[model samples]
Target: MRYLSVLLLSLLPLLAQAVEVGERLAPWTLLDQFDQAYSLDDQTRTLLVARGMDGAKLVKEALQDRPKGYLEARHTVFVADIQRMPALIAKMFAIPAMRDYNYRVLLDRDARVATRYAGAEDKVLWLQLDNGRLVAQQEYATAAALREALEKAPH
Candidate 1:
């Protein structure tokens, strides 16, 4: 019994960070590009969580050529890690440009949301969650590969 307890205790940290394919994501709320509140808990459609600035740019470029209707039809959200940026810089530059994005751009101010999905800050964390549960979590080295992965995901 003591050994079992020790094992369980050792696994606690991993459990906190683990977002397995069949499991539900940790509930989170974030401000969108328009400074409006958005929550993963409210989404009934597939939620896609991408990583940081580069990830966001890659996703934008990859979907740039797709039809507007098709892009609008997808339930995708980009999570940007803006924790390191100065407040003035974000307000002056980032926020305005973010407002122009055609799709929803969620701000992960503290990076807590991004850390819950994946550990890597630089790589694109392509997560597909249904209703709330994660269906797939893929890491891609390139934008084209990321787009291909999304295209092949079960709709």
Candidate 2:
């Protein structure tokens, strides 16, 4: 038991080091509101992650009035972690409402992917990548700030 405890303790640091810069992110695929599969690849320049409904709302407001494919054109992808939501609620209310949005929101239903990165629970995490390698990270707590950054981001 002591050996096992020691082994587990040693592994804690590795598990805690989530989403560091200068590291290549493993590729992942998730389905969007439209049930379209999107994958993280070399072409993805920016990844936007929302850990909960609040963060998702911020992204929604920020993208309001934008044309379709606005994020794709800028090589950006938005992911929303919805693992905590009940499946029945998601089907009856949440997902249907999301279909009206102009942007694609990749659903992290199980949180297996979103939990790999570290960020504030109520803030949107913006990860800048270069050919699948992480370069920088930023967190936005407001829609206006996120909108401004998105507008000025390079295509």
Best by lDDT: 2
- TM-score of every candidate: 0.75, 0.89
Where is model 1 poorest over a 10-residue stretch in terms of lDDT? 42-51
The list of candidate 1 runs beyond 4 A from truth reads 1-16, 42-45, 65-72, 153-155
The candidate maximizing TM-score is 2
The clash numbers for all candidates, in the given order, read: 0, 0
Error of 1 at 52 (Å): 2.9
Expressed as tens digits, the lDDT of each residue in 1-155 for candidate 2 is 99999999988645865978999998899999989998899999999999988999899999989999999999999999999999999989999999998899999999878888888889999999999999999999999999999999997
Model 2: lDDT to the true structure: 0.93
Clashing pairs in 1: none
Assess candidate 1 and give its TM-score to the true structure. Answer: 0.75
What overall lDDT goes with each candidate model? Answer: 0.70, 0.93
